[model samples]
Target: MDNASAITVFTLSGLNGTEKYRIPLFVVTFLCYSLIWVANVIIIVTIIMDKNLHEPMYILLCNLCISGLFGTAGFYPKFLSDLLSSTHVISFPGCLLQGFVVHAYIGVDFSILLIMSLDRYVAICRPLVYHSVMTRQRVGLLVLYAWLLPATLVMVGSITTFILKLCDSHIPRLYCINYFVNKLACTASVANFIIPACTYTIYVCHFVIIFWSYFYLIRTCRQSKEKMSKFMQTCLPHLFCLKILGVSLLFDLMYIRFGSVDLPQGLQNFIAIEFLVVPPILNPVIYGMKLTQVRNRIAQLFGKRDPMPHKAEFLMVEFESSCPNPPQDPFEGTQHRHEGVSLNQDIIQAFSAAACLASGSRHGLIRLGGASSGSHTLFRHGEAVFKLKQQVSELLLF
Candidate 1:
């Protein structure tokens, strides 16, 4: 089918004729839709307020929440309108617009997920370089690409679908997605099937690469005990999210290529909620609860701080006549040590003695060791008591 014969509008056969089902369906759909929206909103607000969540993982999560909002917003309003109003009709342009926005956001969401996986891979795989590689500036640029690239792709796909002529007017689902909506068109090109298939394949390949990167990251982290525990804590939530998204995609693939099995649809629809909603909801919880920095911020936000233990302090009293050159066994020697002092004790005695010795004044040159080879001289300004300690120490030796 060429561009001229393509059908612009599609008539949805989903609960359109039922008078009794409309109000109940509206309430149920409205609640589900509202739940997704409210949950996403909470995540976005939490990320913005929590200083601990300023990192790339949390930023990616915020983006995903925004994308999910766009997805739900694009699909539900029109769905609500169709359900409530006497007219179940959508103009060709309106239907096309809806399709574009929905697919575009889905694409953007996928790209953001890829970026998140890469963020985790770098954090675990290259710990030293992770900050340099995924800095704020670099993250901002990646996010721009995540949104923009999908928008371009959406334009191409939406145009292709809009231009194809429809043989029948009835669209099967409550929502107009790519496959079912496209099936209504009269022009079924290998291009139509091939292009979408290739697009999905590209996304699938992206998903595969992220998992492969994470696999290597996990393997590398296991070699070191310190990093191993932190690595598991950091990567677990992302792994769960990836699993949910994988199942959603799997069902989508099967639904499109194979015959529409009842099992796949049920699983797909259920997993779809997880794919879009769970990541956003879990992101703040995981990052906020597990990380020290985030927890500190949370405390700070609540105007609280952890109590610090008091430390006991004392003075050092013993000293040696001859100061050793190498300071023998600093930790073990007790000759110049305050044996009973706790580690936190301040070295007050030495400072006090030095202060007292430097307080008075004098001015003279004094020699020690009786001018022998080892003799040392001390200069006192008519009253530079700072040199008194040296003179007194030399006299003590003599």
Candidate 2:
């Protein structure tokens, strides 16, 4: 294309050397995209359905997963289509839209991570006032800003790219990025450089805030065992997520800006697409396993019940055997009162045995069970057992 005004469609040159591997790549990409959708959807649904998980941490996690879904949607579907087609092309407007979505997705991720760090800082450092500080209204506003800020900034960047006069209509990547798109322009504009620089500066501030929060978190945790445990349980997962995303993004940025033909084609492709491949799938898996409540809720959702002791079952069986029939009125006759007392003693003995068994203490089981058994035997044949039965029935009524 001679000029941006004359360009209607842009040809993608990223797939030029990978034609032989397209089928295998298509299969792998399909599986990856499927996994991203399923994992993120599972987390989003789990958080929404479980009211007990409606705290700031889980709410932020849901937003993160939603961002993953949003970001991956921009690349995967179109990339899959390109894999099967001989000609890889996108319209001028389509490329701009894809660029906007992809960039906005990245911006939303950084923004959400920033908010999450702030939440953790307030929760761990200002625990006493966490509730007052992270109210429902405030979290809602923060989430709204997380999405809106990125969309607005990225939109401006996309518009700047859209107006640039281009000398080429060939993009070397499987997907669109504003940075890559700007490189095709015939002439550099001040707005192009200035807007992207400002965007990077804003996200760099996000990184600084995240690291600053972590520093305080580390210091607070070192002073107390309880705080340390909380930090490990919660903050470690966030840190892991930040590390994966940061490294992936770094690889992509470096590869796009300074990649060389000397590097292996496969290696360059891997570096270029690492961000889209790793974070979407890994984030949900990491959070699902590390967050105790989320893990337990997931287990419960899939009908995996916690293990119960066999001893409790044994105790129930013994109690049922001893009390074959429901108790009759103890006041009806002398024989009835005697039988009721005997049954009541067996029930108490059974309960005491179960308690000892559940505790899994051999010493306590021997002592408590032996005492209860002997006491039941002594009371079973005693003349005063009927009077004890009357008192027990009155207690049960009360």
Candidate 2: tens digits of C-alpha lDDT, residues 54-111: 8788899999999999989899999999999999999988999888888888889889
lDDT of 2: 0.74
TM-score (C-alpha) between model 1 and the true structure: 0.66
Report the lDDT tens digits of candidate 1 across residue range 193-275.
77787777878788788878877877887898845765666667666656665676565556556745354443444443443
lDDT of 1: 0.60
What are the lDDT scores of the predictions, listed in order? 0.60, 0.74
Query: Where does model 2 exceed 4 Å of error?
Result: 1-3, 307-398
CA RMSD of each candidate after superposition: 15.8, 13.5
Minimum summed lDDT over a 10-residue window in model 2 is located at 311-320
Give TM-scores for every candidate, taking all chains together and pairing residue i with residue i: 0.66, 0.76
